[model samples]
Target: MAGDLYPDHGVTGTENRQYNREQRAGKHEADAALYKSHQCEQTPHPGSWRRHDQRTQGPLVAGYGIYTQGQEILLTFSFCSSLVSGYVITYFPLRGRSETIRLILSDQGAKWTEEEVQFTDWFTANCEHKKQAVFGQLPKFKDGDFVLYQSNSILRYLGRKYGIAGGSNQESALIDMVNDGVEDLRMKLVRVLFYEPEKGTEKYEADLPDQFSAFERILSQNSNGTRFVVGDQISYADYNLLDILHVHLALFPACLASFPLLTAFSDRISSRPKLMEYLKSEARKNRPIVPKK
Candidate 1:
């Protein structure tokens, strides 16, 4: 399995650490502000979760500030990634790429650590070497000395390791198809949105109809009257779609309002007990630091 899989978003351990710290501080600040504003609460629901200013930590440490320095996997989350549904869905399974790995990791009860990193800085710093890596870019996974980049490959590794990839080869292949299909749709949507912003709202407005229509069609076809994207059980695909949907709803309300099924789906997924908890916790812990316009 390892031989067939490639790491899509591999970066040096040092770089990953730096990126994670920044992300953590940003998320923490955002949560803190959200809590203060009464917008939300923290997840895992504990009285001990206190909100604080990240800047107070003083002059931002370079690397490995909070993460346990041991065998662990780093998942980078960023505002840029969260801004677009396509990118969120393509990489972060909860938002889009495929939540298979996330689900497997959660199900296996793996106690892996998570780290958020800014998408822009990470990409800019490593853009020159993207083609050299197997997975192309991030949402990379590092276990011990080995690093796996591609989101799908990471999911498969986690599934197989945790005995959740599937009961048979046919099932595993199906999972891959669903995951790849979501990726394809998300990429197309992103291209339409980002390719020509200079054309103004007219162009942006014109493109959304078709892209959103396609998303609705795909969701309708894949729906079997179940909340999960594929099969009887929840997989990575569901999480990927959910993450993307949340971002879309948050950033592009106009686009989301046009599609009722997508809107409902997004709401349903986000309200899941675990995710809701996470969101609440995230909101309370990370105070939003508004940047100057």
Candidate 2:
């Protein structure tokens, strides 16, 4: 359906309305504390003091707390509306980590009030003077007074806060293993497709068969006819792997033609009403490509 010149359904208005309604409800809930603080006209929470004290006493990533006081942490990326938010929230899955955290506050939603700054602009404006701030970095979270780098660590912190890391240590380790594997493969693919187009595309085409084969093996082994990636319910592993697979298909449509199973899986996942709506909104908005080259 997606490969067709025009999507048959064409992302209906009803779908947009539904998404907006859910989004507004979520935003009000997420901003309740912020709103209440404003109405009270009070200083920041007492926890801010504790947070500052901890950062002062504890090890700082560079010289600042991972999150500064009173700053809404901005998760920086090239395509702010794309799958980056999906990856972060699914992995982190904490309270106050719904669409509002990933989408609304990040200036991608219809009702966002914050000035939407490009990731590059925001980084240059804030982190340029800090020697510890790294260049060519992304998925960085910036709060009012502090900045935190490292996507995986951010994900871990979010997951721990949300209680989605795993019920047991073994499960958590498995989640990490699966996530790392997917991320590793994704990075490799991105390098080839975007970083060094000619060389990378050549390498990608050459390795396409092996890559599909590996995923086929994984699906055959892990999936027992269920639609999800792991366990009985959907987990972060499923979402991350699906996103990785989706990227591959979007970049190289022919790649999907060879692997029927993967193609079928991709189709099935993409056909989901929610995911379809999300993707269509992205396409309509002309979100930048992942690598943004």
lDDT of 2 by residue, 201-220 (tens): 76676787886686665556
- What are the per-residue Cα lDDT tens digits for candidate 1 across 6-92? 133233455444454435654555444433353221233222212211210111111112222221112222111111111121232
Question: What C-alpha lDDT do the candidate models reach, one value each?
Answer: 0.47, 0.45
C-alpha lDDT (0 to 100) for residue 199 of candidate 2: 68
For candidate 1, the lDDT comes to 0.47
lDDT score at residue 92, model 2, on the 0-100 scale = 20
Residue pairs that clash (backbone atoms under 3 angstroms), model 2: 68-145, 68-146, 71-144, 73-142, 92-159, 94-162
What is residue 147's positional error in candidate 2, in angstroms?
5.6
In candidate 2, stretches whose alpha carbon ends up further than 4 angstroms from where it belongs are: 1-136, 142-147, 161-164, 198-200, 271-273, 282-285, 290-293
Q: Give the clash count for model 1.
A: 41
RMSD of 2: 17.7
As a whole number from 0 to 100, the lDDT of residue 67 in candidate 2 is: 22
